[model samples]
Target: FLNKGFNVVDSSVATGKIEVSNAYKIADLTDAGAISVGKQLGAEVIVKGKALAKEGPRNTGSKVGSYIADITASALRVDNGAVLGSARGHGVSRNISEVTGGTEALEKAAREASGKIIDQIIAKWSGEVSGGGLIQLTVRGIGEYSDFVKFKDIIQGQIRGVQAIYQRSLEGGIAVLDVEMKGNAQQLSDEIARKNFGGIPVKVIGASANTVEVSLGGAVSAKTMSTPPSSPPAAQPSPPVPAAQETSSFFEADEYLVFSGDRDENGRVGKMVTRPTATNPEGEFLMYHDGQKVWSKFFKAVRSAAASELQLGSRIYFFEGNHKEGVYYSPKDKSEARLESWWRDPVTDNSLVNNRGIVTVGRYRVDVSNAFVEKK
Candidate 1:
């Protein structure tokens, strides 16, 4: 029966006497155990049987007795424990005295039992009662980038009842595509591996219920490190220097001086003084009462006062004179007319004044003796 491709699970006894050794092992069959084992083994049809034999009338002076054998077979669906069908076969042997022919009788009984089982199994399988299920196929591979979608369609077309869901991941510097099966996952997985669908190799990653996941590279890892860095370090700005406080006390009067001249020889007269002013043509002058210019001398005395304010070095400005509008003066013109013009206002027709100053000694102070003296 096994050679005939029929799975025969036997349990039979002949009239409480085992005609065949170890035949009782075949007799102890349970529907539950058979169904459980059959389902576990993926069997579509399960064959179970029972046999009975009794001695017939014995021939005169012969050591043989006529024997009648009855056999019953059943086919069941393992999936849902449904019985497909059942059949029984009965046969009588005329010569029952020969012990040598017992083997033949047993074989004949087994054959008859299996034939009945197979006939019922086939009849039910071909009938409307047989259940129909689907097998889905999944295919995946790696090659040309454009081939991913094409391969998926090809696999879906070649395998019936198969729906392909494609996914991609980068692994080992290669892009991998996974084709998942949506029906009869295991069957389709086996089919894909066997048929080599999509003209490329396929592998089964996992399967459950109606879905099977297939990956390229045949068991290759799907983990990828292809994502780029999310963020980068921000650039930093240079530190700033604390600005000096702009207070009058921070500046001294003497530091504002540019140049000093000698006093005249007469005690009543002094030498001409040239000093910087806060005006266009920046170095201007003031006439002193002693016939000595004291603007430069007065500025020299206060030169050290504004030393901290001379960031770009001392600038010389000529003082014109003190007025109600404030001190008027001019800037010392440089070779660059653009710089000179920047210090002068075109609209106001007035010179842009800076911080340097020129002062008249008699206007602020009364000291006139030895105020101007010529160098010996």
Candidate 2:
């Protein structure tokens, strides 16, 4: 058996030379010893058999009968104390007077008994000991993005009795695998698709002669390993302003300052002339405009105009009315008009001025030609 490259264990041949080492264990036919030996040696089953040799009478021509050889063999399982199989054989010598040939007859009887016993045992255990073979696999043309170890583990877990021993690198990005097979290989290929590795699509690239060599090739799926979080909307650029509209010009007048005071510097210079000028409290000059004492109307119009222009910051001011009847000028437009109003030192309070007297008002306009101003 060893010369033919078959793994076989023989315990009776003590002087025989075999390449593989033999293991010897001392055990009796008792049930306890059989179970202990089975567990210790990691054997799935323990076989035990006995051979019995007997002498019987054979038919002769004249006398009743001469003595002949007989043998019986019985085999059983020691672990469970169950009778696994049994075989009995008998052999008779041609000459009854030949007592010296009894040894040869006994040996022949034993060999016949042993062969029958072995055949019975094998038939009983054939179902449990079949389909265990080695499977060699080769994987070729796998890209660097593929994780081979993880792929192997996935395949092994899905398939029954498939074990990846070791992977070796070959030329041109090829990998070889020594796998122990306990089942079919086609089932394993179907399982790989079901697992959906890395959420990417995959396909078998190539297969070797024994259907063991497998190659994978396909594009990665949209769902990658690392998923990104949802983000907020990005800021958009302001719309472009029409060039013709941007080139258009608009006139903007300064604030109108109106004041009422005594002309002769008298304690009671009643109802003097009133005038308006474009000026601030610090006497800074600006464009002047003449208008009625209607300060509220002018204030509303200028504010609305400035809002249409998209002005960010604008201001309006109220000053004392002039001594004139009902005329006003932009105080910020001229220096002499600002000094004339200051000399009266008139109380600029709105409540102090009567209906007949002109009141002062100041307002400013803004330019909205720029697109950036609308965005702000």
User: Candidate 1's residue-wise lDDT over 84-107, tens digit each?
Assistant: 544445666756455434444555
Candidates' C-alpha lDDT: 0.38, 0.35
Whole-structure CA lDDT of model 1: 0.38
lDDT of 2 by residue, 92-181 (tens): 444344563454566666667667656655654452246433334665544543455445665666556664343433334555554545
Candidate 2, TM-score vs. the true structure?
Answer: 0.24
lDDT of 2 at 301: 10
